[model samples]
Target: MEEKKAAALSAEETSAAPSLNNNTAIISSDEETQGWSTQATKRLLWRLDWHIIPFMSLIYLLCFLDRTNIGNARLDNLEQDLGLKGVQYNDCLAVLFPFYIAAEIPSNMMMKRVRPSVWLTFIMVCWSAAMIGQGFVRNYTQLMVTRALLGVFEGGLFPGVNYYITQWYCRHECGFRMALFFSAATLAGAFGGILARGIAEMSGVGGMAAWQWIFVLEGLLSILVSFTAYWFIFDYPGTARFLTEPERSEVQRRLKEDHGHLSNDFDLKYVFQAIKDWKIYIHMLICMAGFCPIYSFSLFLPTIIKNMGYTANNAQLMSVPPYVCACFFTIAASWFADRARQRAVFMLGFQLVGIAGFSMLVATANPSVQYAGTVLAAIGIYPQIPLGLAWNSGNIGGSLKRGTGIAMQVMGGNCGGIIASYVYLSRDGPRFITGHSILIGFVGMAFFLTSFMTIWCRRENARRDALTGSSGPQELTEEQKALERELADDVPWFRFTV
Candidate 1:
């Protein structure tokens, strides 16, 4: 009887138990009306993962497809049909980002007031309609207008979802989930290539060209899947239908205990705090450094492959492999990042991988070698982004702070997309050394900036430890704890994860 009792309390006895502050005992809270155990914790996470992740991932997949289908269409002859001139296609790419970037901060701010299901549903329908509209554009001006609208609708989905994930999972758990969700984008890339190739067969069916069919067909799929989001996306843990009331209480308690400070109340001050903080900007700069290459690759991979002596059809078929490789690497790396509780280290290492890939692209004269470089380059940049955002969310304490920081990070990434659009021009085809070399310099800068962030955070954590005499979360009274929640990560006991 004693042996069974002791085993029940042992968290390390089972691998399925969610992470504990201490592996020696199962954590219990002030109220435990229904029994909580390792198995219960495991089951709760499974429900969250199944219920939230697949739908959110679908949202992300369609979100990315609507944007990068442009890349696919570009290969299928979007330029020729629209009579696009030099830099006009690039203008079409560039026009979306400004509107995309402008909407995110405001949308995230609105997220605090609105439920995620309602907000995301509105955005999805708008963008999918705009995506369908892209199929009918006969002029560059019409193309530019549709692209900009797509941007405004799609911009908030990523950062908003990033924030949404945090409300359910704690810091150690957030990174891997973010990677899983982001992996859908890489999947979209792979899937879209094959889907676009099939949709190309629809050319001349509706008095439309192949490129138009790419937009219209893909947009139609997204619109069909979007309404399901309203039914599927859980508002928060407290109200999840799949979970029992006791399980919901336990889930909420675990999140509160994990964060050390929790509040559902909103105020503008938290948003201002996120904006004024220097850390948000540093992470934003890190994003600019990483996302530039990623955007370049996604927006132009088929074109880059075509320039390497393949037909446009062959290029579309070929683009799938790199994204497949990326999806695998991103999930593996994030799993490691979460287990190790190391963010900056993995992020910096991934940046080195990107730098090396770009070096191969710039130096190689061989097409086979250049194609290998593209895979490595995709491998490098794709995972680096989620790791960076994970780090950003891990450090910020409150909802508004995290929402604002995540939006800012996305903004920096889109800013990189702007730079990316200009870098690989139609004139720079075959061996785009200018684009490759500039990305290398930026990725290198990101490496240094991350190293600085690591060092600075470590120093700050030490200062907090010395001043407060606690390196981890400490027991506190109810009144003092209220102050901690109010101060958020600024509270002395709240050490920054380096």
Candidate 2:
């Protein structure tokens, strides 16, 4: 009699399951009562934001400062001290990206095997050590070795953080969270200049140059932060000790409702699926186009400002405002993008703005006009980064697929960093017309690509919406329901966010 009753209840639930066209409620009343309320989710998100976002942001801050401080060091006579000639300084910058690109996919895969806290903290420590080694390097060979190590260690961070953040938030919530994370780079830019200027004053201390002092101090700070991060960074919802059992269940339930499934299993099939998906390649293109200007600006802004006829000190100080502007603009844009639930539109709009800024830089000879262009360029380009990332994360459903897709996107995009390092040649000097032109062309390409992807997603969502009958979730057997739960965004009921 008990077995018969169980079978009857299972049959009833299967019959009541939601179809693609049906308004049948999918969430259980027990779940609704337990913790799916707006207030509960809001409280959970706030807790996550407080605990997660700030620490992740700080890690990236250190990452960017350590990686790009070479640009600052260049201004402080690193080139002269190391006897770097012609493109050697550029070579130092470019060499890092190859290692950086090579490490991203594998590191993300490793992060899946190891916990994020363990993996990220370990990388942070390694990169910090590399940064410290950079300070002690006496020649080009030593500098290149340190740069390569820095790249390999630091490569895991952005993709790792991106994948980790997606686990905590629903699709709509990710834009702002990602913005908060990506904003750290701009914050690094803003403070890095001021910090570099101050460190430059420490020249001759302990028989070190200003550039050496910059690396040592910043690397030490990173090392200190890594110890704290090991304790603070939370694992996924199911395993995180900070949350109560009910909270974990609620978190999982909410994500499952938002998009079917929340598979944490590491499947090779999903990785292959991600690689085969044409959308990943398109996203890769967008990532590459958008990042070119951003990386270039981060590395060369001080030099660019200095070329405008200011003293090196003034240039360092001046570089702060544009990044500060970018930081605020990114937050605002991300907030709007989340509220609108529109990704591609925001990305295209901002890319156009960046193109305009680049146009100004290319066309104008006036120092003030060029500086204003820099402000516009930073404001425009940086905001799109988080939007693009969130867009890709939201669209990709399965855990392994999402991780692999994001890693691929990041890996391909970072290749642009290599391109950026070489574009602003010493010959371009004060008027980097060639570099600006290249940037303008890429940003324009991104704009058109974003439009295409947006249209593609919208059409795909429509087609999924129009499906009926057994093709929908309503007809799923009990075993298939279980499979669908693990399939995530690949489930027919899941709709791509456009």
Candidate 3:
């Protein structure tokens, strides 16, 4: 009887254990589900993946398209239209950068305080209007005005978008989304070139020049996109209304946890303090060095292809391949970056490739080889942008500080745009020997800086680890430690992945 009674009790205990575990699981899940209904979670994830991403990507696509359509216009007699000769075209290109650099910092600050959905959309609309106005330019003065207007509005786009992405996604999720948004630039290059070819073939559409069609169609499209952006795009997670109240709370909690409990506080003093930091200068140098070739390529790709003995249409179409390669590399690089949880190795590697490509271009004159260099250059140049943004932004501790830092980096980096415009003077157009050499040198410098920054970060992490006697190579205060845990749970929390 005792043996039989023991057997019966063991069976009951095994059966009851699962029931107890199930109840515990239910309670834990329920607690986490607080303020997050099933409906809300479903809607939020859906909107993020399906709607917001594509919408924003298209906006950036048009932005890049409008900015670069100038390349196509160059082939369509812009020089003749203005009666330009010997560096005037290049001078016009160079003029855009000063304004771009001057206005970039203020534009970012405005985005932070004025609300993104409103300001960003307004800027887009304004720039598109400027682009359309280009179609009406009968003299160099009118052209200059439109170009300046375009710069004034476009100055906000890239940096603003980078900041905007952070407000919605965690560090880990950021790479893919950043890649998607950044890839729009590549897509714009491809599509803009292709579109230019088709539109250029439509000579004298409504008695306007072929170049006018380029501006008119693209500008109108951009304006249309702005309306949609204004209607649908939210300022931040805190401002999104598409989600239920429960879902809204979940988003707020997630963002707070992921961001080290930092809130977005707009203070002019803090912005000034961020600007004063020396690291901001270093980042600026890195961006300027890295982006010189990119901006140069953006402006000169069609011209470069034309020199290879291709027809005007063929040259325009040829611009597509390099950018297509770049888009793939960008997405692949970002994926590997997020997966490996490292940024330095990929960044250094890509920049090194860019250096090599630009260096090779400087030595080669053969059409096929030069064409190959273009592919390598595009891939090398674009892959570094997102990695850089993530690496620096992730390290920042506060939203306000990060916004300021990003704004500064962007504003400072784009000095290259101005520099690049002047580098390849019209006299050196068909064979831009000096320009290629300078780009190679800058690319080499960028590689060195990225490598150096990576090593420094690793040493810092090691020192921190030793001080804390923690399991990892970095140490933090209790508050920082808790914040790290929260951030890590959302993402893998790998060290600066060099």
**Whose TM-score is greatest here?**
1
Query: Residue pairs in steric clash, candidate 1?
Result: none
Model 3 residue runs over 4 Å out of place are 1-47, 471-498
Error of 1 at 452 (Å): 0.8
lDDT of 1 by residue, 1-498 (tens): 344334322311111111222211223456343677788777888888999998999989999989988888998778888899999999999898999999999998776566777789989999999999988998999999999999999998998898888778877888999999999989998998898888878888968899998888889988998877777876667666788877777777766556554334567887787888888899888898887888888888888888899888888889999999999999999999989988889888888888888899999878899989888888888898788888878777766667887899889888988888888987877889999999999899899999999999899877876786643434567885687557777766666666
Native-structure RMSD, model 2: 6.3
User: Which model, 2 or 3, shows the larger lDDT?
Assistant: 2
Best by lDDT: 2
How far off is residue 103 in model 1, in Å? 0.8
Question: How high is the CA lDDT of each candidate model?
Answer: 0.81, 0.82, 0.72
Q: What overall lDDT, based on C-alpha atoms, would model 3 receive against the true structure?
A: 0.72
User: Candidate 2 lDDT, tens digit per residue, 1-498?
Assistant: 355334433322221111111222255444455626677778988977988899999999999889998888888999999889999999999999999988998888887766677789999999999999999998999999999999999999999898888777777888999999999999999889999899889999999999999899999999999988877887666655678878766766666565443454567887887888888899998999988899999999999999989999889999999999999989999999999888888888888889888899999889999999999999889998899998887777667778898999998789889999988999987799999999998889889999999898777677766773234234346675576645655565666777
> Quick one: ranking by TM-score, best first?
1, 2, 3
lDDT of 3 by residue, 322-419 (tens): 99999999989998898787887898889878877777677778888888888999999998877777766665544566677777777767887777
Q: Arrange candidates, best lDDT first.
A: 2, 1, 3
TM-score versus the correct structure, for each prediction: 0.92, 0.92, 0.85
